[model samples]
Target: MVNIILAIVLLIILPYIGLWKLFEKAGRPGWEGVIPFYNIYGMLKLSGRPTWWLVMILVPGLNILVMIGITVDFVKSYGKFKLVDHIAAVALAFIFLPKWGFDKDTKYTGPSASPEFREKYKIALKKTPAREWADAIIFAVIAATLIRTLFIEAYVIPSASMESSLLIGDYLFVSKVNYGARLPMTPVAFPFAHHTMPLIGTKAYWDGIELPYYRLPGLSDVKKGDVVVFNYPMDADSPLYRPVDKRENYIKRCQGTPGDTLSVVDAQVFINGKAAITPLNGEMKYTVQSDGSEINPQLINDLHLSDLTPVNNTSFKMNATVLSVKALKGYSNIKSISPDITPKGHADPLNTVYPELFPNYKITPNFPDFKWNVDNYGPIIVPKRGWTVKLDSLTFPVYGRAIEIYEGNKVQVVGKDILINGQKADSYTFKLNYYFMMGDNRHNSEDSRFWGFVPEDHIVGKALFIWMSIDDNASFLSKIRWSRLFNIIR
Candidate 1:
């Protein structure tokens, strides 16, 4: 609250106070400088800019650029034309605006945007090649930053979590406007970098200033089956403890939206008691049994089988799509193929059973009986905004992390009682909607099944289409996956 008050004083009040003094010098009523929209109108009149620029100032993202232009013109009208003067006027306006307004040497020369003023001082305003290049670079950086933040951004698939559907080398254009562009929570950051700088290996953003989470109006809400990109929620408690927007990015399919009860039974997902549509190219684990003969390597390559491990000369475990498993059954040497699903009430033998599959298992007393695995887990409810749930041993393990870490609550579990923010509580109301995400490569993904729900503020955007796809292991001649190019993501 103190920081917010200081920000208003420095950014809002002080600048307007300086503008009031400047208005008196320019033969306008000082009170006009303090009014909201009228102050912008006054600046436009003083700078001799067209009234249409005021309309652009009212736009969301474009308003930033318009304001910068108006500020520079207003400074130039006072005969301050140096690059440093313009920088100070925009960046340290509260300090410099008052400094210039009080200086007796400073005077209103002429309207900088007027034709007569430009003609009289044409030689002084002429730019050298270096200045022209600098201006062009500055404009390009600002424009590109706004477009990347508010419209669409290019992203490269970094892992095979969504394999067969989105390959490791697929480049996609994620649309920010689809589910509304989230404003930056950590606003002071180095340009063109997310959390860390490349090569230098240092933090790229300053965490001293943080804005509240907010999103602009969007075309539609997040829907089930959309390929969505979101910040990794566990990063909040990771060693670095990065801010929400600066967390690592992950892409997964939205299997369950807010207000839906999601579960996985026998490796198949169900939402609200209805079977969810599976990804057409989604992969799952299977155990293949064969005669005492070597399975053909060519067959393995043809089916895009992965994680192939020979249990013996006769049995092998591998990941394959449904179609691949069907095709393998037709082979003469292959005896039978069975899905490698962990049955209900059984813990996953391969992974650490405590917290990886059942999040907050170590902290909640009732978690030991969950016995859930990636293949057979949860009729858990996805949290929706304003929805309330009773707090108890059973539901605490399921929703504790979201309430405590994600929603910024103080939670303590004492024997059989729940204490929230120093008060005894029996229930919690979700402050934000959450979605359940899973990778299409079911056996390989560390997703919501492991970490719990993804808060709405963590959502980045909806994946639109793949613009490029490259196979790193392919020969140079066949490196590009041409068929996947420009394909819309389902």
Candidate 2:
């Protein structure tokens, strides 16, 4: 009890210890920085921010930005203008500010960013052989991390879900800034690990200080038919809670945006009742009949037909792009090629193999008759911010998981009546925008049709292009996909 009390007391007093010295350097009474609002008022005076901006401190999310701005200005007042200095001011202000304030040699020049400040404080790291290598590696990691977090990240296609449009082993540069870089919700995490730590198989992130979801202003809002990368929302089921940015990343085509009604009929997607434009490179699994002969290895290789499974001597199933399928039809041995469409009321064979699809929840008042299959699915309206939907047994199966899980609400069903958060409600208003994502290789991909809506917060960014592509099945010389290099993703 005494230790806990001491820790709490230390936490309360430590910030003031740093602030008092920092305040004294700013020509304010040292003791004044220990007071709550008075400390902020003193900071405002030192930062040169208008006193009216002080009111912003009371606001929740805005206060963080205001505090950051004020701190940056305070560091500028000390003539620290380098990017590294700004980073230190924002990230390690408590330690750095106190050190700068208390040190006899470190003096505050004025409220101006001076070029001389750079020369005075600039670190000249000792140039030993070991130090040179360490510095290079450290700076390289920092540069790569910054580029990944703020600009674009290198991604490898790990599955055939996108097939010819994007293949397994294809290296891509997903533009973080294109769809607005998502500020890390779990900032303190292992570098380069997604969800799990490498080798040891531990959680990759420390979820101790989770921040609310926020995206930097983007070049454009996600549009229908846009190739997108997003955190898998349903991964919320995987043992522990993961912040939005730390969840597993997935790549897919945006089938429906918020407010757009979406459905799949015979594997054709319709958005807002119009046929959505398809990607030129998009592919789907097809059942093809051939003239009872072995398929030419060269033909298969040339067309890049993935996972060609022989059903009989005369027929096979393969995932091929539209152009490849057209090319395959040139062979006289190929008789028929058509989409492997799963009929309505019947589940796809993958459904049996995969155990569960999206909305993979098992809740009471079970939606047993909810026979939504991949090829033929909802004409359901995609949930939009501020849109209200009548809640009942029928609609519950469609929107229940999102409302309860994603939106963080308590949903209950009592004798055919729906209640939200302990209150009887006939309708529920959506708090966040939602999106529907589908894979380009329609038949082979496990996507929104099998799962459910992807909340906007889960979106990662737009996939820009393939930087490199390699085919593992080919020889070393042929492994590199020369044509696919620098191919801009559509």
Candidate 3:
């Protein structure tokens, strides 16, 4: 995921970062310009070089060598050529040349390069294959996507929120056949903007202008407990946020079916009041500090990182073992109850799974041992079709009216005041349906609690397995975590 982010950042920001460094080294102020070409001029000036060198940049053959020479000269003149930056600047042109031209800090002053600079430069570029590989990757991704979307789409995991099952960094080949492949959403959407119009898409032609497509419904019913991804419906006016004019996809495990009464008590999930037995509950994943050493956060009792609470900022918890209840209505924290899973050889005792239901108690949370957290918050019910719910009536402080409402043009908004297709609703009676999703590393994720329910359109596909599990929390090689690779997601 981080690599993907870095690649993407390099794509958009590299041009600017490269331009800035080049300009600064040329002795021009970094902020003096924005356009790519003008920035090139700035680079010439900062390096005490001439404007005439600009012609070489556009030239076809001798220009490549001249450009690399000039780039090396500028960096060396400005004292910005660290060992790595040199490799990035000349050898890895696609990877580093632009990056050198734009992003580095050319703020220092040093002498020019020696006579043998070009000879050494040629060798450095040959050694690091990441650049050439990056080029091949781009071509491969394009070719694969062209063949796949029109033919298997590739999916990459971005986080360990799906841990214990599918480790972060897992990649899967999602068959377009399963969901009957959705046509690209932004077929006509303006590049960065989501509102005005869509980019290249193939939906039906309504009257005159082009209409991008919406996928025909259902390859199969999205099963209960399947891991899925979908466009964020709460996406709207959020700055720098591209609307899901294209399907904005998110991956999460489905935990509810339409109309299933759901609740969380003591950090455990209860569907229709029966505790769910997730294969890896309270599983430990270790992370290392900035220095090269590992820290099993779950073992740090004082840190309280492991306490599953129904609320945010669990770092505030004082005692790992003491989750004292405060002011919840009709509820009192029962002390000394253990929520540890039963011994591996036997089934859990029934008492550990279900809390007693009562008439006065509107919320019977499932968590008996964890802190007050999202995984510990519900005993709340999910509404189904024909299930009439009164706005401002229930005690579900977590829910009301405004949810991830889609208004077209890939716009989505969330709040307490929204309606669907012109129907006034604080809550819906359900025209289609809704589902609940949660992360596997349950306690530390920002999920359904922050966003509203996951609507059907947002559904992607189940994450079936893990192909790789690189623990970001380990020594570089030790971080590979071989045991977790190829693990099956339950």
The residue ranges of model 1 lying beyond 4 angstroms of the native Cα positions read 1-11, 98-106, 350-355, 365-368
Residues 401-462, model 1: lDDT tens digits: 98998888888877788898989999999999999999999988888988889999999999
Off-target runs (Cα >4 Å) in candidate 2 are: 1-21, 29-143, 352-364
Candidate 2 achieves a global lDDT of 0.78
C-alpha displacement of 161 in model 1, angstroms?
Answer: 0.8
Query: TM-score rank, highest first?
Result: 1, 2, 3
TM-score for all models, in order of appearance: 0.93, 0.79, 0.45
Kindly give the stretch of ten consecutive residues in candidate 2 with the minimal lDDT sum.
Answer: 117-126
By the lDDT metric, which is better: model 2 or model 3?
Answer: 2
TM-score for candidate 3: 0.45
* Candidate 3 RMSD computed on C-alpha atoms after optimal superposition onto the true structure: 19.0
| Cα displacement (Å) at residue 266, model 1 | 1.0
Which tens-of-lDDT digit does each residue in 1-490 have in candidate 3? 4444654454446656655555556556766534756655655554556788888777533354555556666566545445456545554444664544544453445334443443444453343567667656644544554444433445666765654455456665454445545554444333233243445443322122223344544456666666666655555336524434343556777777777877766556788878876634323222211222222444343232343322222112211222221211112322222333323223223222223211112232321222223434555555554565654434323333223333131111234433445555554444445677776656344456445576554555555555665666567877775876665555
Estimate the Cα RMSD of every predicted model relative to the unseen true structure: 2.2, 6.5, 19.0
Clashing pairs in 1: none
Which candidate gets the maximum TM-score versus the true structure? 1
Best by lDDT: 1
